[model samples]
Target: MLDHCNGHPLAIIALGGVLATKKSLDEWESVCKNIQSHLQGDEESYSGVYDVLAMSYYDLHYNLRPCFLHMGHFPEDSRIDVEKLYNLWIADGIVSSTQDQIGKERSLEDIADDYMNQLVQKGMIQVNRKVSDGRISSCSLHDLMRDYCLEMTREENFLQIMYIDEQQNASADALTDKARRVTMYVGKEDGQSVLKSLSGKFSSLRSLMFISTSTEQDEDEDSCEWIRTLCRRFKLLRVLDFEGRVVLKGTFPSEVGNLIYLRYLCLKGTRITELPSSIRKLKSLLLLDLRVSRVIIKLPNVLSEISLCWLYFPVRILSQEYDNTQGYEIEDGSQLILNKLSHLERVSEVDLDKVDVKSLLERTSMRNLSATCRQKKESLVPFLKSSTIKHLSLKIDAGLLTGNSEMLLSKSSSLRILHIDAGSWPVTQLTIRVDMFPCNLVELGFWYCKLSEDPMPVLEKLPNLRNLQLHICYGGVEMNCSDTSFPELTYLELDGLFFLNFRNVKMGGFPKLLEMAIYNCPLQKIPDALHPGINILCSSILDPLANEYRLRGKASEEVQIPNLNTASEEDQMPKLCEFPLLVLAIIPFVMLSFYFCRSKKH
Candidate 1:
């Protein structure tokens, strides 16, 4: 039965069960034969059953293959880098177990090529063949295929509608009433008139994203007025991203506060300052990205009551200066704000630069805090001491916290991630002494600071340490005398350190070390006796023999060691000489002679 039709056995059985009541086996055979005979002249001609069978094969192959599974990491609407996707699949254990044999039999690159061709033919993926690199650099799925993938995977319904330059015909009116998330990308040619026309149509939308790809032009009142009208209409929107090319000239309208359901608001790269005092009414906002907005106004004092987890404000100066003379009115207001947000939790990540610490501290409990400080160190000291911030990044001068720096370091107990950029500090005689280091520290980065002393003692104290990055720092020359170790360290990166010496360094300390990257460092050689259980990857081959020995597992306990002197001599000799010499030097000379004489007699 299977030989009669060129169909997969599983697909054939499933389809046979579905069509069993309609016809007998002989009847099905007759229909399949008709399909085959019809395709004698026209290759594309096939029966309905044959079409269904082919579609089943395509769906099964796309869902089960590693190449297609890896494409799921990219956003549905975005183009993906094929090379990067393949590398990630290799790392994630998605490739076949017999990958080495497959590579030798039919090239690993060709396997990817064939799979991409099959997917494209099946209409499950679209390929852009016009790239200059002669490789399929980018690929995306059609909307119908994407919808099917989403339904089969049961992925979380995060985004619903995405209109990227589809013609706004009468068919789009069907989307007006559905209770789904929506994203609309507008090109430069889509003017205010188009937006005004559709403003009344999106009454039930959960999200509206407007991406303007417009070149800079003279700002007019009509453009700004249209934006204001759109904001007023979408009062129930949960997320809004009106970025790029749009001019925001007038003061923020107080009517924007009516959007009480707004959770995420991004107004990046706009020329606007001073949010309306009514912004304090947006109590449900979770994230606000206003970076490069050049807004120089003091934040609303009521900002402390909002439940924001991520906030990015990279501008330099805020409008209101911190003053202590305001007495109980200011103090009570701040206390009420903090007490209301005491239950606020930290987000996964955050990035801010050159902001006032007082304004930020009152708003959120940040898990990742990346910001520069404009206030004095003393002003930031209290906020650092109060919160259990996991990640703390600061770009400041070393002179600010010189005399009494212990107070700042001791309070950061919950800090697992720390990034310090000490600009323009002298490296010749620098010392940092903390009473107790962050015990839960997992990742640490240092930039433009000189240590002169070894940081091994400080690093070893962090039992959960995983990653350490030192950039443009002059501190690797010193070595600690104690037997301190980083047992859980996995990644270590050193960049632009001119005086680094690791000759006497041992590698057994880092049992879980997987990667080490060093660039622009003056190291003569890497240590020879690293753990045989792990792979060592370096940019250049300082010692080829050692690398080969590691790759072949010669140093492992399972392999017996030969005579060191004889092995060294043999390894150094020419490869052609070694092969013949090995065959000539047998275990017993008499046995070889007897074998040759017996063969001659026969």
Candidate 2:
């Protein structure tokens, strides 16, 4: 298989995928011989391996063909997030939602997830990473497979890819009527030249994605004239995804509102400072991704059509950066709150902490939000009860996690998921009163809050909390879980607590806990609540005998462990004897202990 593949990755994966379905050894032998015959007999200059790969592609489930093929639109080997890709697929109506899936109470996203998992299992796609929820968060295709995909893209006009490094390849074929989707991978600084050269060529284009491969300053990107021209030319565009690489030093042109049919507009990693007030004209816009764009502020208020927004940065940073430019408007101690662009309403789902509470009240359509910008306690107090917010993640840097959170609970009584990530401040205990958290919170994840005091008694009262994750970055002595606490929690994940004392478990303690994962912790004993569900991770365990010896104050064992190199001395693995038994003891508790044992022995 290796020899026939001739160092091509796609062929190897395709061969493996085909063989996985063939259970008989004779069938495998026949398939292997036939593949070698094809490779040896082929005289064409094109990749012989693509023949094998084409079989895999053709064998794909018919419903997934278009969805898989459409991936050619993205740059080769792009790390496409599942959220982004699934949304794109759904937006394009590539995956049809069946009644069977719906009958199982599965969403289209759930069915799509199943499809992606099957594709990965069949070696058609590669999984990059999985999140805590056991969902594939990101994925990438092999370069060779991406090349084959691009070849098919050219033949079927699926999407046009223009390589800036190879100007000769940038032909009129891309500007033809068939080219509906075009992606410009700017590998050189001459993108301005290329754009100017291809001026008026994109008439019928629907989707235009720009991926900047050049690190140099793209000055042309800052100008509104080129953008206006592009928007004016491509009046029928539905998706304009810059992939957040273009740094718009100026305002996003008002001409963008002219594209009445636009649905998805992503400018996540850009330096876009403001949105022109004219943007409210986009009546068809569904998603507006402005996440991580620190310079953005003063959004147009007339947008009632937008359903989802991805703005995660704080607004204070925007005020700080642009305040000097508008120095003439400076007043007394308070910064002038940028009001909404008139009385427009219904802005849903955002991280708009930087916006004034007065203006936030007008945005009555807010759903789940994660805000980093701090607001005056009094100013935020009223809306806590008035708002119908569900999931809330407040990144309170000024130690507001312990603030009067009861105001939050009172206002957003319908809150379900609450994530509080403590900022730079060092908190050692729960300062907020017992009634701060809402009784209906179903999930909670806290990060970096040093909460020295265990407030389990308060959290225990939350009747709906089914999942809880605590991630403390620094060293901590212990966190005590009291009797009958977290009774409804189905999943409990604790990380970075050096010591954890599960001191007590009264009758019916954690009655619904199906899984418990502990990481980077030194838990000496198993709690009475421990069942087959408890998972003491490899990174958290120590050999009982070794720990006992250490308790007896002896480092007598000559156990050698690999030492991590601090200096750049060719990464030599020198021996060190400090607690190798931790590595040895971690074997039995692994998810599949027998598999781990076999691998360790091998």
Candidate 3:
């Protein structure tokens, strides 16, 4: 018997076998002896013996067989909280009678402890001790053991379906008998009636997921009504996910508020913009994912006051009522409302593209700001000057940075990180006077700017420069002049510049350079003299490397050539055989040439 059931023979016999003889001392003794004999036959018999003894003792003490059946509820590979387990046991009334002879001497907790210890010794349960709480907090089951438990403990008449893809009538016919859990993905045509049928059949369902796979264009009112009814009926749903476009055209049903027990609500890529106001009623909601949902109109004003540990929403100004200001508010003071969220230390990103930063700067206090400007450069002057900002990102039209370079650099002095996204042919040169720029700057990024001159002059002035990025800066810019070196630079990135070259720039000499990334530059032959410690990353090395080379032509004339005879060895030699010998050789050579010419003429 022990060999047939590993160590869980008691649960198996109690759940599967008929009553053995009668419920008496003699019958229990006989059963225990038989189990013990079976265990004694194997060398791996210790665990089997313990299981038999614990089960027999439990049966003798607690008459109901269902008391031991509840252990199968713990999921495999997951820990069971001791307090929760104990509470569930008490609620199920699994305790032995106090009037019984064997039960009178022990408390139910003690009996449960003994059973747990026996299970541990029999290799059925693994106990985990949490050090922080100083308690035995959890119990886990092995896969094999859990499967055995499920097999022995599950009701014989229970139904299990893996995947269901049928019409509503077919599904309804199949679900006529009570099923434990049903999982089905619905097509657009059948999405409505299928959900209605499922809601009626499976009220006690543990999980329901309606995955829409259709690419249908039109969503009718019946579909929305079907979803509304499903949300109402599945009040006890633990996990609800609308994977595809399951839009709620009208407001969500107020009855959806009853899903208070929902743990995960994922509405990824849905067109539904606004959540029902009743969404605030879900106090137990742990994860609410509304990514890529275009229909969200506005987040509730009370959201800032709630103690939500996780939230994702479009960046907006906080309400003004939370601010300490009263009747003295300005007429266009909507920008001032962002100040109310100053206490939100957990907010990591803020986009102030459309808001009036002049008003917001007076009240708002943010540590990280990502702003996109639809207005002119002067309108963003106040936000650039913010002292609380640590990271600043700007995506503005090219004209904003033209004459405002001084103003931009002035406000940048307090910034540690800066990202500027400018348009093509930016009104201003991508050059800066480094002397007045921020000394604390660590990272600088330039995007889509026409940079014809070297950017090193400003870069070298930054004492704390660590990262530099240039994207789409065209017009054949070569990095020359090693005078302005980044001593603390770690990362250098260049991307999407067709004519940018990194050769002969002597970038290898950067003392602290760690990583370099070059992509889509279409260049061959990187500078052979790169820093040995620096790591180079590029797409390919080819003739495209010529794109980074800068061209220059000569603007002046050449010097006159000198006569070779004037600087001969004879002139320099110190009177070798006297000057008369040199004159005699010259006279003879001249006379012989004259005599040969006279003979030719005669």
- Which tens-of-lDDT digit does each residue in 477-505 have in candidate 3? 46653634777787788776555555545
TM-score of each: 0.51, 0.59, 0.44
* Number of the predicted model whose lDDT against the real structure is largest: 2
Rank list by lDDT: 2, 1, 3
User: Which digits, one per residue and each the tens of the lDDT, describe model 1 over residues 489-570?
Assistant: 7777766555556555454566666656655454545443334434333331222333334345552223322211112434
Give the number of the best model, judged by TM-score: 2
Query: Candidate 3 — worst ten consecutive residues by lDDT sum?
Result: 550-559
Name the regions of candidate 2 deviating beyond 4 angstroms. Answer: 1-49, 95-108, 165-177, 187-191, 216-221, 306-349, 352-419, 423-450, 453-602
Question: lDDT of each prediction vs. the true structure?
Answer: 0.48, 0.56, 0.48
Ranking by TM-score: 2, 1, 3
Candidate 1 clash pair list: none
